[model samples]
Target chain A: MFLPVSASLRQFARAVTADRLAGDELAGAITAENIRAGKPPAAAKADLFREFILKWREILDANSRPRPFSSAEYVRSLGPPPSEARLVLLLNDICGLSQRDIEYVLDPLSKPFAELLKEGRAVIARQREERKALIVEDEPLIAADLKDVLENMGVTVVGLARTADQGAREALKSAPDIVLADYNLDGQKTGVDAVIAFQDSHQCPVIFITGYPDDVLKGEDVEPDFVIVKPYRPEAVQAAVAHCLDTERFFAIDADSANGDL
Target chain B: MSNEKSSAPEKRVEKLQIMVADSELAMIDDWRFENRAASRSAAIRSLIYLGLELTKSDPDAAAKLLDQLDRA
Candidate 1:
């Protein structure tokens, strides 16, 4: 996603510390080359382009975009050039950092965000457990992980289905709290189809996660709480699940409460 | 401004840091690539906004709204 500020704020940053900006030639090179390549180029934010600022910009860009991992591994093969700026915000702009980037930065096993997600779940869980929770996954291991994670957070995994048919059957039976469906399943039917099928039986949120992002993830019928990418840190997964569950609670509380359970 | 920065409530919702994944997030170089269409994050954000909008006037009627949207 593009930032709120100037798109080419790269050069001004490096010039601040390096005591020298890349000069006109280098500035043109960076911006011109990027533009030539169909990528966004650096632009100064008005007078913010003091010499030092330009230096820092380059450095910031380097640190922020730190050469994107070259593949789907999402694992950074090299460390970034050292700098003392708040980098996470910049990392947010990093397009190809592996699924592990956030996890690596914040240990899901022990980070504050992890704790927050857990706490977040409890907040909603303590409320009424009105909706049935559904888990649709073909991978037994990941399914077990979700079940464990949800159960640990005190949100029931009402039912588990390995295929669209099985998930749809469960949906018909329980009408689920939310469906945590893997985007691509083992059978011919996809998570989108599963969501449509399940919704046909009942209305519930679907939270999907995938390793690859493509057209398959679309469809107006599915209002997923979070579409986590695959290789997501445990904390990220927990956070997404927590959100959909919470949405259900909020949805239930609407004054006219649909099921009259609100 | 300081207090605004300090006391300004974090946008974080409990348990869920965010509802959706990036609509465009997928594997680019190695990081998640966010697609142009409905990434999970994008969907979540939209859903949250939609949820807030719907619940404001008629929460119980949300199902009907969703139903309407589904039909629309």
Candidate 2:
């Protein structure tokens, strides 16, 4: 199999097992078996994947021995255990498999493949819809407005702060999934400083609502991915928040993929 | 042989040069072997195609993934 295909398989295994070590062992065993079989280089990928599904229960049972860590630890770090529908989505969306390939791999489905995929997307969308944000704008009015906007979009506003110090304290109290901060705060430290501090303990997406985009962009300290210029519309904030959440999810997956050997 | 030569017109002719760190090179080599690409060049082209398609679909996610890959 190609490197991408192998990587995809590894990722799929990881998602299904929700344990890095187990996923590595499972994929390694399957790949070794395939090599021993002396399958042709052009062997069908779908067949290999189907074999993975067929062997999952046996392999998982074999590897269920006690380890240094608990499965709950792994589940907490990653998201919840993936359902079959989510597994299909991960294969097609994250693993880059074609729909036809998935259909072949998951043959004899109770429901149509399209329906399962739609359900998967809906589950993912609902998860994304529920998010938490920390707003750090010095102006009371602006901070309230930001909170209202996020709440309207179904994101829980965790905290509102007028200075970098307050923001850091709030973040320590309750870790936020995302942060929206104004460039100039009530104290000497700018939003960039506050973001850096927040990230020191917890890493999350930061959207800088700054009047001077140039200052934030040119600042050597922190380079934020999402920045809304001052006098921004509600739509702009909403769009930035949505994009940041999506990017954060992708980062989480990438980090999980890189944690262990394939 | 005649059919192969006839298809040569569609073959890639342009050249590009770039540099990568040892770790990155190792990843490329691993990818090349896994995909069974004919050469490093072929593997790199395929990677580029994949990256472009991802970027087209979700620019933010693609950019973040690229950044992670660079750090990896």
Candidate 3:
């Protein structure tokens, strides 16, 4: 509830005084006058200060409002999302701010961006209890690490499978909320094959981990919910798992693309 | 202690002086008192800032000016 305009004006005044202030003669006279009036000459800058206030009385009056503006109120003023250029203009003309000031004040509070981020995080966090994951990696060490990461992020790791047949069998038995699969698996079956095998029966989101995702996932019949490229970061895996679990029928490609939706 | 203090970077500061008429000075005093400014120096600084702000061409330019002000 802070008054941004008033605070900015005060800050501006302080900065100007510290740097490029002029009118020394006026300041001297004011000091002399203060001395004659039995006041401390040390506080003699009064007249010069007064001069400044008088010069921009209209600006001061406009900024000195009883209630400071809220981000919600600002969002309401713009209604729908306007072009960035138009928004800049409105902030300057209506709010009496410079473009840089507008960016500092409004960018963090952008309705669409803030709302989408907040909703996404909240949705993912709230649904953590319902999410169960299956880790399908041929490498035992990698599968164990993946399971640890998934479990740390509040996902229940149902099982770990080293081959496509094992992954398909475990997915069917456990009915996992999401699948994390490495591209190359044992028995010459890729992770994409594992996902395709159980995708219809399980109908859960899949996150494909691969060194060569472009080569493996490009020609696939169905895309994954998310893709993590090797060597994977723990945070990246956690984020991908959360995102995939929260979104239903998620594919890495755009929803409008016909091939990605199956 | 002296060495530590001296190791800190020195801030560059400069002094400026300008002339104004008695009538102009009086007007400044009137405005400063009426507006309840913290000090005469504060009033002067505010006026100069406001003057520059008013001259901005449009919102975009004004915003850029503000950015410059922040940097300054």
Candidate 4:
């Protein structure tokens, strides 16, 4: 496969599986299997994605338990589990595949692509409209700025904490849809410590907006998927928040399945 | 004097086959009728061209679509 096509497939698989490792592994396995089978190279982008969808379905079937998958049992507050069609729509947003290409890949779709797109949009809009965020920054100006940006995106700022301890306390008091934390705090505990404190209970997405991205990335305690460096663009923040919110539910589902709690 | 005109040579267009659901076909037919397109091929061509034009104008069309979705 071509480099760009391979990368896009990896991304699409990641969005579908909601686990980076699983998604990458699945993509690699499929590519290797195709090569071993001596199949011709995919003639169109849709062909490659169709192969991925088959592999994903096989995994889902293998992992099927006696009890049917239910989102209510695990996290009722997060709303319903994302349907497969919704995930496809989300994948389109991430991969930027054309409508015709997507239709080809997900042929016999339970719902029309246009209708699914509309429904997915409404769901996302509602989620954003009611979304709440917690900002952990010692700098008063930065915290205020984050609040304003999130508010403009329709995300309510639940609380602002100057220290890790306070951040954790605020998070516990009111659960946030996502958390934006700075690396260094006013107190002994860095933002990493603060995130570690509540992440187990909360399981919300974390975006580290800090000058010391290296320190945060190299930390042994927690590994965040989204990190923005200092002097960030508001557009960057908005994009991160949108992506984090979009994938949070899917991640929760994956976690539940891993723990056999689903 | 002979009248002569110069222009780029026409390129050969290959025929590509695709599968569409019944609903999608109906959508195409509806669009063709509404726009008074000459044929299904014409309607499909116009739609594809429109989509390509939009993408060219705004590479972030998907992101913008998401924003629109949020509003919708």
Candidate 5:
């Protein structure tokens, strides 16, 4: 599909002209080189277009037979293109990509489809991990919003607590997979206090969200993956929760102890 | 999306992910070849997903379905 391209891409495509790439057509290697120089998304996509052409070329080569093909060979036969023609056809077929995008990011070379597909598979696997979490906020509406976010992603929210003592009790009893607590809670306890207390009984990860920024949290008593500043995006919260759950180098507190390891 | 749901509901085919050691993979390859069958990788993956789907039902029916599918 045609994608808009930035000028940066075209310059990179020009850089890789020394290769045996046909003068009549852009080379896939150009895409790879652009990525090497840190190409933009447009250029990266151009690379896929180049890759498809190359793969089709190879398939044509592998299917060729010297003699005229019999009817049996019809299914295997794909009319081959000389180098220049192949590039031209592919460009025409997958047009819409801006010249700049094709040049800088996806010149003619980029990661193979296999590698990109593998990366997608790994991302899917990462998103499926099981996690135990603690919700440390005192506000009912905010806490409930966070809970829905977690559940939609297939994570179980084990308990809800308004105060640090209550949070600590639920944390110790249920031993949630992770703790998500507000920086300031009702009465005497802060989210930081709840996190410390919960850690004493369980080894789940903790995340703190507060209205105030680094000007204050840098000094407070805290142990958490990240201190999420408030007025948050749900995407950011989900991402942080996903990261905390994925961080397995720590919490060697037995894989099956509270929440099973991803 | 509609076509996806219209498959044989009782024996729905779905994807399953499996990871095995190289040695185990070789053994599976050998088993598939000796049986004059296509690569069992797809079958294995399908069976795994099918088994999981069956288990999502009640325990008694799950056991029965698993047994019927020869996947217990």
Candidate 6:
């Protein structure tokens, strides 16, 4: 109920601000402030809650300790700053904020807030799906082609890692969603080795595109998530990535569908 | 059902203990959070699975890989 939410919010407010306002005192102050601002109680509460979360996140980020996966923390972890409407959905969905509590806190805006949640979800989903990829291909022409292909698929090419070591460095720095690596890189360390090195700390899906299948097969490092034979169609690259992200059962189904169409 | 009979199958696994620097540990923790995995173990397992799945071309690829790894 609102009791838990109110208590938690007050506790967080005290922790962050180091101000101790009694429970009713804080609520009364917030209500008075909302009235002065010419905003409805519900909307004001929602806004206040969002602001509190943002402030708390900043405080948490400044500290050395690991952040908790609480409501606000989870929202902050979603890569980019979420929209107000999206925050509402996260509060409702992830935080288990009930309609009554939302009404009490967010007020009359509760119904409309719920309505706007779907649109916000689509926006956030699109942003989340804007998968960033690091291309570790040595060939300039091939790297450009890969970048174009990935961009066309709505993936952002963070950078092209020409050598295995550079690829590892870029991947560590950017923390890309996926890696597109060529088996034979420019340096002594193969693309497979580079991806393995990246995986030692950061875990991102990788798709290996290479002409020398045996080179990868013979490698001692861990294997990539998916391998596409060279001279591949652009569509094949898209399908391979989709397959990895899709449900495990759906992957075979998707492959079957692709084959059926062919 | 009795506790033993109803219990999950015992997984035969080797514990991999590695010494990582503070920075490296932070990186792993960050990766785990970003991936939305339940735990560090789950994150590592998912990563290994993804790698294995990508490299595997056939059903018996795992056995072949083990053989190759052993020989190497």
Q: Which lDDT tens digits does candidate 3 get at residues B1-72?
A: 111222322222212245888998888878877765434554665577665656664667777777998999
- TM-score, chain A, per candidate? 0.50, 0.48, 0.49, 0.54, 0.49, 0.44
Stretches of candidate 1 above 4 Å error?
A: A1-131, A215-223, A248-255, A258-262, B1-72
Single out the weakest 10-residue window by summed lDDT for candidate 1 chain B.
B29-38
Q: List, residue by residue over A184-237, the lDDT tens digit for candidate 6.
A: 876588887887777776766677787754444221236555455577667556
* Top candidate by TM-score: 4
lDDT of 4: 0.63
Q: Could you tell me every candidate's TM-score relative to the true structure?
A: 0.42, 0.40, 0.40, 0.44, 0.40, 0.37
Q: What does candidate 4's lDDT look like per residue over A104-208, in tens digits?
A: 777767878888776655544444667889999999999999998888778999999999989999998889988999877876898888888998677677877
Taken over the whole model, the C-alpha lDDT of each candidate is: 0.46, 0.62, 0.51, 0.63, 0.48, 0.54
lDDT of 1 by residue, A1-262 (tens): 2211222233122221110111222333344444556654343333222322343344434444332211111112111221222122222222222324433432322334444334433443454344457889999999988887677666777888999888888888987767888888876897777888867547666667665544332323353544556665555555445444432122322334322222
Judging by TM-score, tell me the better candidate of 4 and 5. 4
TM-score of chain B of 5: 0.41
Candidate 1 steric clashes: 56
Q: On residues B1-72, what C-alpha lDDT tens digit does candidate 4 reach at each position? A: 010112211111222356999998999989977865434554676677666777788869856975897998
Q: What digit string (tens of lDDT, one per residue) describes model 1 on residues B1-72?
A: 111123322221122242323542333212212222112333344445567777887877987877897997
The residue pairs that clash in candidate 2, if any, are: A2-B34, A2-B35, A3-B34, A3-B35
Two-chain DockQ for each candidate model: 0.03, 0.02, 0.01, 0.01, 0.01, 0.01
How far out, in Å, is residue B28 in model 5? 58
TM-score of the first chain in candidate 4 relative to the native first chain: 0.54
Error of 5 at A123 (Å): 3.6
In the range A1-262, model 2's lDDT, one tens digit per residue, is 1123554465456446543334544565577677768976435667767777766644334444522223222223332234557656656654446788887777756678888877665543443435788999899999999998787677889899899988888877778878998988866898877877877677676777877654543313365545566676675566556545542132233344223221
Recovered share of real interface contacts in candidate 1 = 0.00
